[model samples]
Target: MPTLKLAIADDHELFRKGFISMLSNVPDFEFVLEAANGQELLDKMPGHQPDIVLMDLQMPVMDGMQATEVLFEQYPTIKVIVVSMYDEDRFIIHMLEKGVHGYLLKDTTPDEVEKAIRRVADEGFYYSDFVSRVMHRKMVNRLPANKHPFFPNATNVGLSNREQEVLQLLCDGLSTSEISDKLFISSRTVEGHRLRILEKTGTKNTAAAVAYAYKNHLI
Candidate 1:
């Protein structure tokens, strides 16, 4: 497998160093650079183009939110995974709106951190359980009166009930294995459903499919 280059941007020197040390042990990850703040990360970006960035939300200069915006705006191919201590819905939703590939807590385990990096690199998103729950709750709470949260455009689009169930779980940020477990189906079946949903919605990926559903007010 190809190694993924990584960058870390946090204001805390000790935390940064410890993260770097932990990541260095992961076989598939290559630590390319480190930054004390968002501006520093940006300044180093031109010189070292990492495939993924582990960003901290709060910093002295530029901050993670601004840095994430600028990074994606300037280099759309690079992926960003926001690793912060904040678990508030606003922070999670704000980063999601900014198009981050993943959201992780600061207290995340080394295994989950590695998993998040690999998942985001491969699957285009890695929403921890907390992040997914928060997003689902917010979206459900914001639904208009007398409209089904899972099928806003059910009549307009001929999505089957099973597909809607799959899509809703996807929007909740459940991985394929998790979805399969929850639905009592095989992972391959879940993947087939995912592909069909993408095809039906004319989307290129899971993220785009979810975006289409939300854009058309499906979920």
Candidate 2:
């Protein structure tokens, strides 16, 4: 069987050690590297490109968010699974926007952590039951006519279904190629949808277009 190479970035030494110890017992996983913070992760990345990264959200010398941005910019194929203590919707949305493949709360059991690694390594998404519920609630509350606090807008220049699908994936931080693969569309078709989305939403770039979609409940 092929081993899945993994790295971890966290500030707490004990937690990092504990995580490595737990992962060491997993048969299919290989803990290849560890870092204390995002900057260290970046500094060490060129030498070892892991298949999966377990990252803590709050760290010094560049937080997980910053690290995610850099990682996506440089190594788009590396899947990052956030293993943080935060469960807030805002934090989850932000991480999703920054392109994290999975979100597992820090208090999750070792078995669950192992499962998440396997799941994300194979499928590119891992959400515990609680996390899945939270995501569902957020999505339900954000429906255009819901009139909830999280709802962005009710009636706007609504994007087409395909456009909305692309926009949601984009907001979730999937790249053009990834989106194309997920939707089983051509890259050129995905690019065309993105351009039309920007034009319809009056946004300048992918980021702006995503912001507009979220702000307008188009996604």
Q: Per-residue CA lDDT of candidate 1, range 28-81, in tens?
A: 789899999989999998879999999999999689999988888888888998
User: What clash count does candidate 2 reach?
Assistant: 0
Indicate the residue-level lDDT of 90 in model 2. Answer: 80
Pairs with steric clashes in candidate 1: none
Q: Residue 30 in model 2: shift from native, Å?
A: 0.8
Candidate 2 lDDT, 23-138, residue by residue in tens: 88878788889999999999999879999999998999899988988888898888899999998978876675565777889899888888888867754566566755565565
Cand. 2 Cα-lDDT:
0.78
Q: After superposition, how far is residue 61 of candidate 1 from its true place, in Å?
A: 1.8
